[model samples]
Target: MAREPQTRAETSSSPLEPRVREALGQRLQELSYSFDEMVLRIPREEMVECCRLLKTTPGLDFKLLRCLSVVDYVDFMEVVYHLSSLSHPHKVTLKARLPAEDLRVPTVTTVWKGADWHEREGHDLFGVLFEGHPDLSPLLLYEGFEGYPGRKSYPMPEQRELYGE
Candidate 1:
């Protein structure tokens, strides 16, 4: 039989949960557990600072940036960062939501150098502008490619011509 989903209170019993909450403080919008890993949601404005703290904090040292990607939800876009602690058996998924009209967020490269390419990919595919990113050059797409192909609204070449997009 399958197990039931865990509620916030049920998952809060993990030893690292309290520490993560304390480290993030007011910046943390929501915290919960999924698939045995912690998930943190923070405002786009606080992403860079939050990432830095997660890496530098004493007990909750999330030193590894496992992945960085974006999900287009039609109305909004969600940026997800998977972070893991090398010294401890802890993993966290950090997320920030951006409005469709304003797809901009501060770069986490300042906190994790490995974010360079990931940021570029997000820019190329999702059209997210990573402010303070050293280079936002095309990573997966060609330099002159039109509309973000990764977005749900992106039109095909024939559709674009027919619709005058």
Candidate 2:
């Protein structure tokens, strides 16, 4: 995954349009932020810690959990969490991809109460179980549903029998 080179205008748009690259304490490290899209690419193992910091850090102030969902990419399933701040209105997206065989991630119910139904929705739609979720019951679908219906690989049953392809 090689990153594309930044153009002149892209390098100086809204300053918050894509990312504002700021030098870290260590010259070798820099913090990059995406303004338009709230995507963050932190290491998989550090996902929980990063979210914890975002919730507690004064300047960051990402106290609101806006959305949580999952997507399937054949071999893996991605769980995405979107957080926003009421004070600063800054937003961030946190994502974690787990193999289809083991689809689970750390729950943020402790950080944001809004995570309750969002985590349940993720589990209901993508079969992504959440660790420490307290309750993993179905939020939308009935209990006996065999599979997650939102998956791309899911087979759709024909309500109408017209076959004239």
Candidate 3:
């Protein structure tokens, strides 16, 4: 049967290719991968392992960890890792959500040596903790700073805690 190219839209209800569905089930059962993009959620506990696979896996050769940044929602944090493949010229995004309590994730430095400083910068501003990051402290901020400036919940203390109350 002839089928039209799927359209990108506000809502999608499409059947998966047998292989993609199988791979998605085998690797990341919790999240179904988008066929249009390789975007997938690596389980929080398996993040480091997933990055290791990304580097070594065929076809999805995400050899470079180009960016490590974060999004700070008031109640939680989302870590974004943008990776690119030198050979394939393709890209993938991996995201993990962590609670504010234990805001930690394993480092990708072992997979991408460039991740060291990117993780550090994330820790400095947004307070993301890269578990195996070589250096996770103060790339810019000095000691005794009360809060992570970039967190949405982190209002300037002078306005609320220090002077107001």
Candidate 4:
């Protein structure tokens, strides 16, 4: 069965309730808007601090890093991190938007050690540079790969060059 889309109020629940967004907004004044009803759009510069609070805050301890994905929106890029609390049954999506010119954001490895791989994959696919990442080496792409294959502007590699068939 298909579920109906939820309103902003209904989307943000529990761990990432409005209070949490308000708190973050108080600390970081760059809370423009949400990418999705449930997804909070945090500034790229404040991503690390936001992740820290999400992991350590009492009722909103989002300790598990579910996944990290990068989106190329032509004009800019967006990094999304899905977080969940192991001790509680709550989850939220955190996002940081970056300009195409400066595709750098602080690594969340300091907050969640497992973020290392996710950061690497983001870097490999979208050309996002996770500053302070221990290893931003390719996770899916090999060395000498010309450009980010995941980007909308990256040209598709020739099949003959790839397979030599």
Q: Look at candidate 3 and tell me the lDDT of residue 10.
A: 32
Candidate 4's TM-score = 0.79
Reference-based lDDT, residue 95, model 2: 66
Clash counts for all predictions: 0, 2, 0, 0
Tens digits of per-residue lDDT for model 1 on 1-165? 222233454364588878888988999998877767778889999999999999999988889999999988888888999999999888889999888899999999988999999999999999999999998999889889988999988865687678785
Best by lDDT: 1
Candidate order, lDDT descending = 1, 4, 3, 2
lDDT of 2 by residue, 77-135 (tens): 77778888889856766667687788868887877878899888888878887888989
**Which regions of candidate 3 deviate over 4 angstroms?**
1-37, 156-165
10 residues in a row with least lDDT, candidate 4: 1-10
Score candidate 3 by lDDT: 0.70
Clashes of 3: 0
Measured with C-alpha atoms, the lDDT of residue 34 in candidate 4 is: 39
- Residue 21, candidate 4: Cα error in Å is 3.3
lDDT of 2: 0.67
Q: Which ranges of candidate 1 are over 4 A from the true structure?
A: 1-12, 156-165
Each prediction's TM-score against the native? Answer: 0.87, 0.74, 0.74, 0.79
